[model samples]
Target: MKAENPKASAEVVWANNNTDDASLRLWREQSRQLLLSEAKARGLQSTSPCLCGSGDRLRDCCLRPLR
Candidate 1:
């Protein structure tokens, strides 16, 4: 899926049909963290395009809401 859409979320791409695999699960978590870090580094404005390149505003797109 990454080849088709490099910005696709790893969780959505790497799902194991609701079953879990240790390596894949760890990889998904790590990928999420990495993306989150990159997003923080961008520190984009609400009007700016999302870092994911989905054409949505940064605040309206992918990253998890920080608690």
Candidate 2:
């Protein structure tokens, strides 16, 4: 099962009702952009190991662009 968002459910609900696929896609893109910006802010390199300790490089894992 996918992990639930660490953010509040109500917050997500208010952002863009998860019931809609388009809304979900938009939300995910927004989240991804934010994450990339944050990584850049911290000087995290694309080739660095993932912070998740998944034994994969960032570009090959979390830092990869969304599908």
Candidate 3:
């Protein structure tokens, strides 16, 4: 799905599934935080294209409602 739509985040892809598993939710949150931390460490700016390959600014894409 991501390959088909670069703009789709993992959350977006899994949104329809709606799992109640605590472990899975924790893992997803941790992974998201890790990715964001790594991006910050790499000096990614809000105006930079997202590493997710969404072709959208980081702030507009994965960084939405965060940074």
Candidate 4:
């Protein structure tokens, strides 16, 4: 399968390699925070377009609340 965001992947790798110990520590913490944010987002209501350019509100469309 093709990568969705090759640029982002490259940037992440560069950031990881160039970061100092303290910066890397902060990056790890931020990554953890992002993971938690995404987990919480899985349940939160979304009434906007999708990442695929589909102009559908998630809660009203594909990612709608479980019935």
Highest lDDT, which number?
3
lDDT of 1 by residue, 1-67 (tens): 2335665545454534555677666766786677667766888555678786779876566544421
lDDT of 3 by residue, 7-66 (tens): 645444344456556755676677678768878899987788898787999878866633
Which order, best to worst by lDDT? 3, 2, 1, 4
For all candidates in order, the CA lDDT equals 0.61, 0.64, 0.69, 0.50
What's the true lDDT of residue 67 in model 2?
38
Best by TM-score: 2
Evaluate model 3: give its lDDT: 0.69
Q: Which scores better on TM-score, 1 or 3?
A: 3
**Candidate 2 residue runs with Cα over 4 Å from true position:** 1-18
Rank candidates by TM-score, best first.
2, 3, 1, 4
Runs in model 1 deviating more than 4 A are 1-20, 45-49, 57-67
lDDT of 2 by residue, 4-45 (tens): 655423444324443587766676688678767876887877
TM-score of each: 0.47, 0.54, 0.50, 0.39
Kindly report which residue pairs in candidate 2 clash with one another: none
- Model 4 lDDT tens row, 1-67: 2335664333442245556877766766675555446535775335555433457764454333221
Global fold similarity of model 2 (TM-score):
0.54
Between candidates 2 and 4, the lDDT winner? 2
